[model samples]
Target: MTLPLNPQRVSVDSISKIKELSGENIKACMQCGTCTVACPMAEEMDFFPRKVMHFSQFGMLSRMEDINSYWKCASCHSCSVRCPRGIDIAKVMESLRLLVLRTNKNYIEPSQIPKEKLKEYPGIMMVAGFRKLTS
Candidate 1:
């Protein structure tokens, strides 16, 4: 049986929380795609930075819940540097991560990771991932 797609509702509170945390005007994004073009991790993201901003502007939190775009963000500030409206897209991504973490849900369980994989990954990468993915 085919399942019907239900559109996710917008949450004004989510939008406000993002603005409060990021201190950036998400509505300032004009869908210019500059952030997406400038993102080195865009290819790895399920949604491009521009689309993430678009969803964020509308407060589509449910739609964002399962996406890996924000988690894939490197926080490298490349998008922030290239934005025409001076909107720090990286901050927005960070806010999304914060929202998820506030619910006490971790994107990845540190304990579940294999010891060999942890040893293979660089310490800086592990540190960054823990900061972003863990509560």
Candidate 2:
């Protein structure tokens, strides 16, 4: 059965932005639930991986903030491997992270880090860590 979509909920610009950032065809997702089944953190996620894809594809961008399930992804590539459509589910999650981070909404503050530990980590690690934590 097909679900009806509200025109007001559809954001073509946001969908295009996600596609551009992740290099994915969001419309290609068939909502088969393979990604959810493959997600190791599925039980922990509020929406699971498959639902996250649907939220993006369906243009329900506002709901993404409430679910925030993409942050729970461990980037194990299990979902990508299981997806029959070959969607890079991991990249999709990253795109979501990037979208949030680009808005300057910091989830983690630099002051929260220990200065000594930060010094020990490599520059790339620090930057990547902040990117993940901040978003």
Candidate 3:
């Protein structure tokens, strides 16, 4: 007996885990391309919003990690609003980013910056920048 080739099924465990982490129905996506079309920064992504959705649905965890789409996402909610499946795509992107951020790897450290530059920047800017850079 031969099994049918289906890349999506190969990583069902990953799909389920991602769904649990993101709190979204990973199987609800129908690959309508609406998310990619509605994304404001789609052009900047290595794999657009729809492709990232597919990556999650298909349990392609390695593909998901290799792509830079999650980082490129602007969290504008445009894709989420346009999704026919009503999936919160922004939250999915947030989950992907969180997976990377929560691994004890801070993208930036405050001490690395010069005191003069830190003082020169506005308070709100520093706060927001640190928020994105640290965690």
Candidate 4:
């Protein structure tokens, strides 16, 4: 089996900017995998929260881009709230999510998202969009 390779040319300044914004000392992360286990979405995430840390730590932020799990994050702050390294993992995920989300110009509707909905309806999505446009 072959593994996907991360792009080789990620910018250090971008990584630094992410770290600064997230308030996470990426160097402190030891990739202990504890955050992955603690995350409720680990089983479903293509790459766990810890993997996102590693990618950003090594300047492989390119691959971590557009990872669907990122959008799924409730920002429950569970990973950040539990990380032994004391890194703000949730903020880190949001930082990355914002990076990817900001890339698009057109608005995507809740009905347009191509993912399985856990609930009978997308209450969170609807509410979030409503609040965004209203406020």
The TM-score leader among the candidates is 1
Descending-TM-score candidate ranking: 1, 2, 3, 4
Each model's lDDT: 0.86, 0.79, 0.76, 0.67
Model 2 ranges off by over 4 Å: 1-8, 113-128
Model 1: per-residue Cα lDDT over 1-135, one tens digit each: 110122257877777888998999998889999999999999999999999999889888777868899888999999999999999999999988887788688888999999999989999989988988898
Superposed model 1: Cα runs more than 4 Å off: 1-8
Q: Which candidate tops lDDT?
A: 1
Q: Model 2, 123: alpha-carbon shift in Å?
A: 12
Give, for candidate 1, the lowest lDDT window spanning 10 residues: 1-10
Q: Number of clashes in every candidate structure? A: 0, 0, 0, 0
**Per-residue lDDT tens digits of candidate 4, residues 29-50?**
9999888888888777878888
Residue by residue across 48-109, what tens digits does model 3's lDDT show? Answer: 88888888887776676546687777789998988889999998887777666776555457
TM-score of each: 0.90, 0.78, 0.77, 0.73
Cα RMSD to the true fold for all candidates? 4.4, 5.8, 6.6, 5.9
Ranking by lDDT, best first? 1, 2, 3, 4
Across residues 1-135, which tens digit of lDDT does each residue of candidate 2 receive?
111223246677778788888999888999999999988899998898988999888777777764557777778999998899999999898887777777766656888889997888799977876768584
- In model 2, residue pairs whose N, Cα or C atoms come closer than 3 Å (at least 3 residues apart or on different chains), thus clashing, are none
Q: Which stretches of candidate 4 lie over 4 Å from their true place?
A: 1-8, 105-107, 110-124, 129-135
